[model samples]
Target: MQIGHDAIIIGGGFYGAAIAVYLVRQRGLKRVVLIEREPALMTRASYNNQARVHNGYHYPRSFTTAYRSRINLPKFVQEWPTAVKQDFTKLYAIARRNSKVTAKQFERFCRDIGADIRVADPALRGLFEPRLIEKIYVVKEYVFDATKLARLAEQELRQAGVQLIYDTSVTAVSKGVDIPLQVALHNKQGVQELLTSQFVFNCTYSGLNQLSGDFSGVCSGLKQEITEMALMQMPESLCGLGVTVMDGPFFSLMPFPSCGLHTLSHVRYTPHMHWSDQRGIDPYEKLRGYHKETRVDRMVRDAARYMPELLKAEYKESLFEVKTILNKNESDDGRPILFEKHMDLPGCYSVLGGKIDNIYDVLEKLDEVI
Candidate 1:
């Protein structure tokens, strides 16, 4: 009963943790080891996700990572029916004519995947609260509860009998003949090396460069930033356009079943943190001049420009947080990389670059590899 495992799952976030659960349930691997740098699971990107179960609204722009991920999300959400406390009627996506994927392309996207979406502007309820957007006409779509999905996944993994260790930090990893991979961690008892089996599932967002003896490729090169905001009233659908305005950047408005919240962010560059292997985020102190404030202001301001209602809405300072993300693209082959070998890494894998929209897809991959 007390043994390493057929898998060594690195990182205790959504993708890694969920893969551990799926491997145990689907592959029936009881003896397993989980290494999490944080004191608990899902303290990373998983918790920082938009918490929106994206409705396959953003699909394959030439089979891009975002598009490819669209294929497996429904199953991911269906896996945990109870964890999901909310989902919108539909997901709306709007794009400016000059964007990478245009209106016509988006329509074809709906037809290609048979994804449930439409071209009409749905009423904003909840934070969808009756607003000034009544007059603005922009291409719109919807998304779902990604955070809920993660919460559900965590519950399911536990029910399926998986042991998760938190507050444990991985100092290094190595591979040899007798022990294919050795994961050294900082536990209460002091430094200890875990002899992991090969099937290592790495769901560590922005922290995948630890594998040693020829697995350093696990850490891909890309920058990521995530900012989360909670909105009081919510609506049935999320609508707005992914656009590049005068400043030349991309932005989107994400609607949730109302974490009693909402979020807005863009995939851009900032010289904050490059390497994903850093620990403990630097807390921001200023109300408006801080890092969190800068990011949120950028997000909400862009969203307000897209959705007219967001322009006049009163600001509520009590509901917002910034979550750093794995910033990169699947186009340059910058996806999560993990090495799987039974008795080699045990249950271990690496989740490289992703958003809440694509993490579920990564989980499914871990299931098969493990």
Candidate 2:
């Protein structure tokens, strides 16, 4: 069977849901349908992330990404006031050894980006190990409750008159000789076709390669990796604050406001292993899923070096998700959101964002394209 729509979004994550709302409400586009393989939105990488609404401090190495984040941080807060947590203070500490940026450089970077940065309070400063950490600053960063964000997105999509289809996957995409594009969707029933009207957005995240071979064959810009995050309980003193040790193999322990638990994620230790599709083989082919006990042990062990309090935290669980990252000049640190319009195929667009707050950048770019 073939279904027709004015616009079809291939992913129903927060970015895709936001785009669907924008296209229908802001652009006055009717007959839009958003399809997702999962039963609900934000269950994948969107929900299984660090949840920090980044404000340039995390990516001092990439100025474009940092500045874009700084620009969008407030816009996101203003738009989703109910979904974000700003009452808690966020502390960013620079690593003494294997540091990416020095104390002066980090301060200058934040100042240049107009980010609110200052020395941590003397009482709060003692929480980190002085030997491993060089400097700590209180930055303007907050965590977004993915559950609240998803609920808000669902309401927005509904009010915007978007037809959201869950438990559906876009297995194949092909350009029609006469029609704009033909998408093959699979589910429990069988395969169905969706004929779009000259505009289609591929927001499938890690499922990009599964949708089209051309993305990996001709366009060749995206790189996929399996990443993990560990969740644990936090002590009372650390409940109202979030801490991150910068550079090299460090960790970020932040309170998950939604569940009242803390998440400890190590930059280099959390991901049990990472394999790339660009390595002449597919990584997901060999990998099954996340190993909870091993990854959690590594997370607590590595995080203990900076915050010994993590040693007392009880292990909750670990989440594994396929992270779709942009291959920017062979560097894995770029966070600039990617929105490719008809790179290899007309009437088709691919969207991949690094940070959640960068959703504004994605919407702005989509408005320009649509």
Best by lDDT: 2
Error of 2 at 147 (Å): 0.6
- The deviation in Å at residue 283 for candidate 2 is 6.9
lDDT of candidate 2 at residue 299, scale 0 to 100: 77
Kindly provide the TM-score of model 2 when superposed on the true structure, using C-alpha atoms.
Answer: 0.93
lDDT of 1 by residue, 1-370 (tens): 1234577777777667666776787778876667787666665556544554444454344345445555555554566555453433333434343355554656676667555544345443223323322221222233444455556666776787776777776665666445455566677667565555655565555545434444553333434333444342323223332222211244444554435455554555222233333333322211123444334455566555555455544434423333433344434332333333334344345564345545555555655664
Model 2 Cα lDDT, one tens digit per residue, 69-119:
888988999999999988998999998999878989999988898888989
TM-score of each: 0.69, 0.93
Candidate 2: where is the Cα deviation over 4 Å? 212-218, 278-293, 329-332
